[model samples]
Target: MGACDRNCGLLSGAIIGAVLAILGGALIPIGDFLINKTIRKEAAIENGTIAYENWVVPGSPVFRQFFFYHVQNPSEVMNGSRPNLKQIGPYTYRMRYLPKENITQHSDYTVSYFLPNIARFEPDMSVGSENDTFTCINLAVVAAPAMYKSGLVQIFINTLIKSSNSLMLQNRTVKEILWGYVDPFLKKIPFPMERTIGAFYPYNGTTDGLYRVFNGIDDISKTALISSYKNKSTLSLWDGYCDIVNGTDGASFPPFVKKNHVLQFFSSDICRSIFGVFKEERIVKDIPVYRFVVPPAAFASPLVNPDNICFCTEKVLSRNCTSAGALDISACKEGKPVYVTLPHFLFASKDITENIEGLYPDMNEHETFLDVEPTTGFTIHFAKKLQVNLLVTPSSRIETLSKIRQPYLFPVLWLNETAIIGEDKAEMFRSKVSTPIKMLHLLEAVLIIVGAVMFLGFMVSYFICRSKKLK
Candidate 1:
């Protein structure tokens, strides 16, 4: 019995040590993989800094900068507001404000004002080759000379990153605001004194109604070359970096690029137009003018006309199919609900690659397409015609609603810099951006998985030791 007990204790100890060792070994790879995978999918700056055709070249704005008027106390209406806006030069603006308190109120306001729009600070940045000139609007007091200075723009950007405690400000691009992209952690940060955002128009045309026009193009060939080139570069840059951030196998182009939607312009024409135009511009000027075309299916949407046939609405300028009575066309097959694919680009500032790799379950599956179901997780809706960019206006009409009680504009009051401006649709438009709240949920799941495995290994070892002790 004595010999048996000794042997059993020895065996049990060995088993426990082995289990513990195994757990540690397993955890190293698991944590490494999860952390690495997440980094690639979400972090854009990690792989290597990527630039577009005009990205960071000499004489261009090395960095875009904007002053952020940080309100020390946002609740007080009169206090801590920036004032005396002045213009110093083209692409440059200077604004000054005084922090004051409302009469008969002891409450105080803190005003931290800096240039809110960074892109406008660069004056020398080359204008578009064609009639397409780059312009910045609604940045600072629009007249400030600081808004137009390239050197000042770079300086402002460096200073903001250096001074601000906000993590969202790190490595942020003007496109992030205009494109409506945000990091997962940004939502957690406090408000008022935090960084607010503005639009950055990458396309040659005006920012307004641009989404509709791009969606109007049914084929890649119809798209402007600049748009196509941008899409390709964005995909390549994201894919290459996502590999490192996610710690997964590389070569995942179009990872979050959801090609199934009509937004991506899946045909080869997108690339051809983008690169082809650049080549043409090098040798000769004045590329041929191309008229926009709408595919037969452009106007089809579930809400608009469910018949699966494309119809033109009041918004479409190319052709008015509504008067033609073309809704009855049998483009949609029998027993099939007519639907058009739309592309949704997903970008996170960190660790999204791992979550996607596990979520998708296949690295080889590059193009993520989805049918519009609540379960498919597509927040935005697409019309039946792949070409027609359908604009859906909320029936409540926020602009009209804001006119009545402007103070109620922002119900959420996130980051507290006045979520809604009076009656203007711009604030409502800005509020719709994808937030980091969902990304955190994904991160929790990964941590849970890692935690469960470690716990299991620990429990198993504990049981073996207990069994030996009893014997």
Candidate 2:
């Protein structure tokens, strides 16, 4: 071949290679930076945005399963014997949140709104009907004496209980036990007391409080985080730092989640903020997620987790503080002796679990966890499991409670509230969020590799042509 032709070929190859290399090198980081910035902007809470629409009304279906504990030997339990308990039906319900109410935008890049909760029983999803009966402790009978301090009031309550033939244990339908039932004794009483009693009596068709959350206009990292609840930044129920409500509402989180970062959210049902730590990576419905779990130390005793000391109240501290894995929520539950723990007492103290006969803690089934998509900070799959227990102690002042027994943390019922991203939403997420990110990464890699090969070929050809001309 002619020297001029060979030299021209080398020059053309070098120019093409240099151009490709420059484009590849410049686009990779710039494209990534721009895409991430766009995501952050889209994730911000603003009117008419996708994030705002989903926040106002979530598209996922939320299911709430209630597992009631039935007492097999109620008489034996009153006489200081360990309660032989049996886990009954899981009466599942489909829960939905209503549209946001009284939405207001503040000057500080925050939005305030109220979201109500509504639940409907799903017979197909449940093991049995809500009409099924179970032998359960009468909460009013056990809690009356502890609620009132006056001796005269206690005597009157005791007399009313006797007159109404109220027993420590009574047969109640699942609906009555969970929703609300008009107690005969409670109706007859004159004091200001709730005549209707149930585990979730006040929750149905109710809003927890007015919520104010950050809109991410000023700071993207603080998006969707709760600024205040019920017009207050702290709760009066808990002490010290426990009173401070610090977290998101669990609907959405800030973008770009890290592996070691703790995910926190405030649950109105539990009346406090809880956090989850990274457990592992998970793949769900062709989507990658970061599985964050409630660490065992979250409800650990003050000895194990000094940060939890503020959770203990004066009454709980007087009794040497609550044991490991038990949270004394009496302050939040209208002064009732109510405590919450993991399902089957998964991480509870040995003494608490040993007192019951039927409990079998299993981490796979009982643990609470959140599977979040790290890029968008969306919780794609999550299950929040919690068991409610009543602290039953023998009261000498009340006749019905004058049983030969010690205090027992009676297992009442447990609930598992779960939700997963629907197929339609998941598909949309893949198309919009996951696919774009993946394509960007794939393009970046391909460009770099192809550009490097072309540049190398150009260098080899240019050197060979120059050597031939010199020869």
Candidate 3:
């Protein structure tokens, strides 16, 4: 009876200890794997750092600078010329975000600013590109510049843009303001804005006319290159960093990153343009930042449309797309006159910038960079820099455009939207990241090993005592 009772206790002890030991053994790698997996997917799904909406109260002016290529040698500049680039005002603009409900949501919960009241603050409504250029535009022919200087032109242009019961468009959209209100002049531009939105250009960032407004960058509804937003939507230009997913292994990457990881994306080219690979990892203020550089070859790549980015084909007149350091994404806007460049011409080739006297390009101030936390896959610090350049090619027939030179892409404005996780936020995130590794994992693992050994020792003692009792 005593032997049987002792065996029963040993059996019970062994079963309990074995179960606990198995769980403890799994407390480290298994726990670590699960935690990392969960956090990475959460980030890919909803990056906490991403906010698609912002409100601007009437206050400080948004600064914008313009650089124009001067006709250093008139004969050379007639068709296409090197930029004797002149720098202009850091012109300030004031605008407010449209009301929430007033904003257009293309699909899902995507909503963006509507009719952003953009008013440029000219000291006295004076038209100034800073320097006098005889080749760019003849002020005598384009009275619009004169009118703007007098402050009456904006009011006048505003009236033409305002919604009137008598006007054809009730409340004119941004697209309408740019190209849609045409009568006879812009008839030959094939289809504009999007093919998916039918022939006519839809409303601001809208797709099928049914969905008039959509969030461009944070639109997480889709996974394709367009990031699942409305295809060919101009808003996609704002965000080129799509979600990071390893196609081969069905895993999410934290941007601590793998060497072979490449940023493969599709653009207005309507094809996949492999942007580049992660070149290096940097530590800024103890935070990790991953830097991606655009290979000069990207500008020359077949994926980029030379005809769409800029129209100069002549050897002497080329927009020098390769060296200019700007991505001609005009195709994304359906060739309706748009170009994207790094802020303040930071990445432009020195060969091209040497000709420009007043312009200064610095990587420290203008380089495009992304800061992501390796553990949480969170983009804590980020700056997506881009400048929108407008081609000011004028045909001899248009009265206002007759005087402007042929094939000049003008820098209208550039913007850098930045966000950073402050020290407090960073510390909080660190706690979250370390908790699973230190608390539950370490404790449970130690308990498993210790409990298993102690239980086995107890069982051995029980058997030894039982044998002694029988003796």
Candidate 4:
């Protein structure tokens, strides 16, 4: 064959190989990352040793390695925060994992500190004089993914890398480093007095066991917490601390949970374990739980014209205190003492569902409702292109903030509003519009016809040339 024909054959073979490689690459899968342990021992004098329990998947080979690294290493875990940890080892380290989906918003991630495993080693002073005890070390592990909704693996690795870098370069105390970025590091904690806040997901399901509500509120704002802390002196001594009156004689937590230090909590399996420990210790504190009154549904009414939901935010400085704007507490329940007040904003939805259900599936079906006629509130609209029918019910309970001596009010708002656009479509189960069968068939048909014509032309051209040569 000539040069042109030879090049064409080679090009076709290369294309076929490339296509096969692409197909093979798409079919295979890989396993999760592995953590390998390099060295683990007691700290020599001032040197540190880390001992961590398995933290990864139970049966994975790297589980032990993860335990060691988890306690010894500091990891970057937030959007803008660094992975800075303090090394005070010679203790046992424990670890827990939060699936990427568990925390969907910035408010879901928070700062956590705990005692981990221990490390012990003997000191060698002067040969046979006497081997005394040297440095003892204790370490804890904290890992959080930067993004919860997507980019999970990348985020986790990035956090680990940042934490490792910080550990190598910075020498500050863990407390100082953590406190420096406290505002963003800690998730917006709800009022400590409530049993549960609206932020928790699967509130009534099995996963719900991981969470407890000493004081729970729905859709609270962050501005409230900061304002309250600033005006702590002007406020009651119990302003920052949640006041729980134990009707069961005295109040005590599990032995593991230190009573003196402040703790921030979340809905995780770890909470379940802690609660189990509390139950084993027989520590049940009976405190009053009062619910907070929800804002008018008008705030969540939909904007039909714009196809968008809106929110209204306001900042008002505390009048009789030095704190910033405090949440409007007038809407809290009555006949109950206010035990604890966490700063939270009152949010009204422009849409019937608040569109929050997509990320926070924990919405109380009953609490989400439409306000109409007797209720006299704003209307909630679905998307602008779609008009939907809605259902609503009114709640008879009137929530009050305080009943003179009441410390906290946790009102259970279960009202709900569901949109009914129309009857189900007959083709609801049909395939999406993007299916490629029709296009594929059309292209194939065209190619076949073109190929036939080209073949015929080639044959005819050959015959004509042969006849001319004969002439």
Candidate 5:
């Protein structure tokens, strides 16, 4: 009877211990499930909210230039040319985004900026006196064909200053040409003002509603936002415009992605599209970042077209890519055209760069990349590079027209807008996000190991007691 009681007690102890151990083991997976669910919810930006982003362009990289227009064909008065033997830019450009205002419960948003008087022209050597256009190089203003249709011929003719039989520019700066000078007839921005960059006007951000009124005069010269939300998109900023393939947000990706994925986003500046593949997952200043390198194929996305970006760039006088490559925005300047090109002419053939002088195409430095926080889908670090060029085409009717031979896309400037989290914010993220995730992973492994050990220990004790009873 004593042996029976002992055996029975051991059996009861073993049964209870096994059940407890199994439940504890089960908790490992259950805990992980809960943790992931919490993360998805927390990382997701809620709808009806706003988020702000800040970026800065170092002055060392602000490059602007003007190529001298010369006669390639002495027979034709306005034929050929090489740019002035100089470069411009590397000027400091500071940019800030207003809280992206989420309008609807879904992905619709209005992205704006607080433009605190951007220094359009701060007295650079690039500028020349009216006399300099004759001796040195200068950007000549050309009237877009629309100037005639809009009945602005009279105004354009009126605006031209009479010079040595050539209608000359009034010693104006590029900013003065684009945004207008402070004149009685012209409305100049008084100081700091609000400018609308554009919005996700369409429900589908992949292709529509990404542009804003760049210049009030021309519909085609619209400024663009590189990213937007997709249909049924979350309030999370990355979901709408991040993926280059499907519209799904990377932040909403499963906890474990096996391989690199295709990441895409929109860019409205020159009205082009960009897509890249994420190569590796790594830590940036203690934050998890999915780094995407711009592949050569990325420029092929259809969104980077005239229909999407060029309102009428296709018709810009022999400026459109003959290979149907780049969407020329030079025509946007209905008065004088300034063409925009991807940094280093990424997609253009070698001939495009060869034909134009002053274009130092460097793929290594100019390729676009984005470093996004894997879970949050926010752009923490980025270097977006772009180049601006002035289309130098000679028009015979214009008196200011210098005798030029061949038309050239003169490189004016290139800029790099880089962004990174401030040091103070990085520390906060590490404490709040990075440290906690590591702890959860540790806890998960510990639970499984401890549960299995407890089960084995109890089973061994039960068998030993039974053997003794049998003896």
Candidate 6:
């Protein structure tokens, strides 16, 4: 009877162990499948979803910091000398995206909205006041000759400059330079044109464009990705693939972002789509994030990065090409000879940087980058840095520009639009997303380890008992 009881006990132990092992092994894959499905479902851009709430209105505070290049020797520059520059500011502003307008949801799992960018000056966050005055290029005088190619129009523009007593340089307050100011020369022109000019005159109180984005109901991977801009899938500004409007609106990205993923986004400010490549993994607010940076290849010369050939203008193509790191966006900026580059000409050609003084390019300060949590594709921290330059050439037709012997890309100002997840938002993410996922992972590990150990122990004991009985 005792032998019988012992045998029954062993049998019961074996059965329990086998059941645990089978259940745990099966759950390994099943648990993973469920977790992925839940994440995908939550990631969808629907009402009450985290993605939707974040997209409609971002929780992070975005700060737009402007750094102006004060040309110290405007007269010397006019006489063919390389312009000595002084970097002034971090005249900072708090950027706010007003609630989305014209929101329309489509049957094909997409939604459209118009987002307006609004900025308010923040004195405490700034290095200087907006009323601070600086000596800068008279953009109106410099841009006129380039805009009017016809000799007849050039003559008229030259007449206007002479009549208005407009010089190649002028002193203007930072507020007037960044917001809007009625250019004395521009106001006098007979032709209908934009008289009020500023670095961000058009941007303030303006909607970027109509953005139609994927809702991710059909495919979670495509969430928040822009399908079209202003009702077009491609822009009229550039040629071929460069015209294609790809990626999200820089507010949010799709879930399950991979390390090797090339994260693309349409920048209304630059009037083009840009992409970021994974640089490294970083920890932000105790959350692991993948750092993606705009590579130098994005602005490389056509020779080095053939994809950039489409961005080249007839003038640039005529010269074979401009050097790496300067993108001539003249077409996008209403025929203005505007070139966009990384702040302080970071990664730009020596030809461009050497012609200007007082530019110190530091990767930490100037590089454009985004830190995203890979699991949810939530951007924890990001800095979008860009420098605006004017292609200044010695125009013989325009008297004011005639004395300048050499043509150069003159740095005007740069901006750093940056944001990071707030502590409140970070805590919520940790509690709701990170902690839950971690707990599941721990449970899975515990189940696998305990079940395997119990099963193996039962097997060894059963074999030993059986061998002893047989002996």
Candidate 3 segments exceeding 4 Å error: 1-28, 40-227, 231-256, 264-276, 283-289, 293-297, 300-324, 331-336, 344-356, 392-406, 422-425, 434-471
Worst 10 residues of 3 by lDDT: 243-252
lDDT of 2 by residue, 91-128 (tens): 99988746787888999999999887788999999988
The lDDT of each candidate is: 0.23, 0.84, 0.41, 0.20, 0.43, 0.85
lDDT of 3: 0.41
TM-score per candidate, in order?
Answer: 0.19, 0.91, 0.45, 0.16, 0.56, 0.91
The Cα error of candidate 2 at residue 444, in Å, is 0.9
For residues 236-340, could you state the per-residue lDDT of candidate 1 as single tens digits?
321232211111000011122222323223221111101000011110011111111223222233234443222322222113323221121112112111112
Candidate 4 C-alpha error for residue 368, in Å: 21
Cα displacement (Å) at residue 242, model 3? 15
Ranking by TM-score: 2, 6, 5, 3, 1, 4
Residue 354 displacement in candidate 6 (angstroms)? 2.3
Mind sharing the TM-score for model 3? 0.45
Tens-digit lDDT track of model 5 for 1-471: 686776677666666656666766676677667755555444333332111111211111222232222222222223344433334334333343222222222223323222122322223434452123222123433332223334355335434423222232233333333333333211122345322111111111123222221110111111122223333222221223331223222112222223365554444444334556787677778787887766654433234442223233344434443432344543323334555556656666554465555345567677666676655455556777665555555544444454544455555445665656667767766676567776766665665566556657756876887787679
Ranking by lDDT: 6, 2, 5, 3, 1, 4
Please tell me which predicted candidate would have the highest TM-score against the true structure.
2
Show pairs that collide, candidate 3: 106-213, 125-149
Please give the TM-score that candidate 5 achieves against the real structure: 0.56
lDDT-superior candidate, 3 or 5? 5
Give the TM-score comparing model 4 with the true structure, all chains together.
0.16
Which segments of candidate 4 are over 4 A away from where they belong?
1-4, 7-13, 16-20, 23-27, 30-342, 345-471
Better candidate by lDDT, 1 or 3: 3
Residue 96 in candidate 4, Cα distance off native in Å: 14
Error of 5 at 304 (Å): 13
| Model 6, total clashes | 0
